[model samples]
Target: MDWDDMRVFLALARVASLGRAGQVLKMDPATVGRRVSRLEGHLGRRLFHRSHQGYALTEDGLRLLPHVEAAQAHLSAAETPNDTGAGLSGQIRLGAPDGCANYLLPQVIARICADHPALEVQIVALPRLFNLSRREADMAISVSAPQAGRLHVQKITDYHLHFAAAASYLDRHPPIRQIADLRGHSLIGYIPDMIFDKELDYLANLDLHAARMTSNSVPVQLNLLRQGTGLGVVHDFALPHAQDLRRVLVPVFSLTRAFHLVRHADDLRNARLRRFAEALIVGLRDQVARLEQAVAQADDQANSENP
Candidate 1:
């Protein structure tokens, strides 16, 4: 019944191990165990099933999760926003793909930290999977369109990707006269089947013979491009700032991807997520112009080569 008890429950549920959960909450394992046991006693239902590996949510726990999370979100929002009192002070968990974490987050994180000094932002970076339903992250940045969910979704922008390589790498490869020519040269790409969606998987299947290396990690892929490993597909958002690489437009076929921002249905009403979503949307809108310019430049470069 106590709010702190519910907080402990949520943390424990997420971390899946009493020891790990206690570490997160700065509590001893025994204290965490006692609090969870107390919570279960109050509810008259077992919340977790313990095993050698870790704890798994029981049917009762699954039923209570949404309500518990909603209560916590609302409680956080109940704080007065006025500057005369203590401001919002809690952690916000964000989920992003490895690529976004590496390329897009640092500036936004710096800005968010500067504006809300009391707010703590924790990023859960994964190669491709982040479970918004389990509250792995309150907000997610995704490459594909948002799937079926009650969550509020926003399409940040449609981003174009380009085949790029180190300038030196291009100098040695056969001239990219057309898309067909890509079949003959070695290229680098994302690790095969690393992305989840069917469309992305199909795109990865494209035989860019020039691919000599591939990886699921975007930073690693980018580093390979910089090292002149081979031609690779990269987003312009991550490309414009690259000083060492040149964008190579594959004539006849160009790949564009959309970026979306997603939040859970319950968290949309929370104070922290609402404000953070607004700032992120604003930042994305501001970046749209720059994104379009990059696309146009890539097209222009491609046209010049063909003409």
Candidate 2:
């Protein structure tokens, strides 16, 4: 099968729509469709079932995907490395969730800009998921665990989150001495699935049926919290660097979500990509201690207020 065809198929599989796949590839939707059809014809089997929601993989497509992915990885690794500057000098496309960008990336971005002035870096804020295989982005910062794939991936940090409320709201509402007490209060939340499973997964431990408001934008949700709409589960990194909010007395279980730095296996060999990745890793490590300190201070203040 044509390697380009396989790539298109993989993009379609990941995106679940010809339009979205085309957007990532910078190709016309018809061209993406033609390429997928050609691949199916070459294989002499129906690979996808077209549906209103999007294409669903047929049994044949599911069976062929693993082999296709392996072949692509093997072929990609065989290329001779190019002479990229021992340092970096080209644009590195980075994608990140807004919450992560707001809380975690400012220092990293500043250092990268200072160190590699020639490198034109572009950061795309992706509140929704981005497709890496389609080259939609060169690197991604996400809270989710990396999936099984041919990716150069590493966990940069484990971020913690806990439920918190405005001091005024806590005073007006009934006391929350236990997780069960949260049921009576209005709740604010991130767009349910966009939040990494681990971060909110234990909400199952809480008895609330649903959030009063759900937003992908942390700033918007935080604003609502300031209005005393409800308590919210917010990342330690994203919480305000002030004492306006207080942690309720519920058992604060630490929810650890992995912050992953990922690049396509092929992109990993590009010297610029490698250098930026290293810089990001180093820059983030340096600030992690400071962030933990800030969180500890917040906890201390919160304890004082609640008691």
Q: What value of lDDT does candidate 2 attain over all alpha carbons?
A: 0.73
Question: Which candidate leads in lDDT?
Answer: 1
Choose the strongest candidate by TM-score. 1
| lDDT for each residue of candidate 1 in 208-296, tens digit (9 for 90 to 100) | 45256777777788888898767777777787667577777555556777778888788866776777777766666566556558756
lDDT of 1 at 76: 61
- Model 2 lDDT tens row, 30-118: 99999999999998999889999988778898777656656755554453255434545645578887777777777778788887777
Q: Give the TM-score (vs. native) of candidate 1.
A: 0.83
For each candidate in turn, give its C-alpha RMSD to the true structure in angstroms. 3.7, 6.1
Query: For every model shown, what is its TM-score relative to the native structure?
Result: 0.83, 0.68
Of candidate 1, the 10-residue stretch with the lowest lDDT total is 80-89
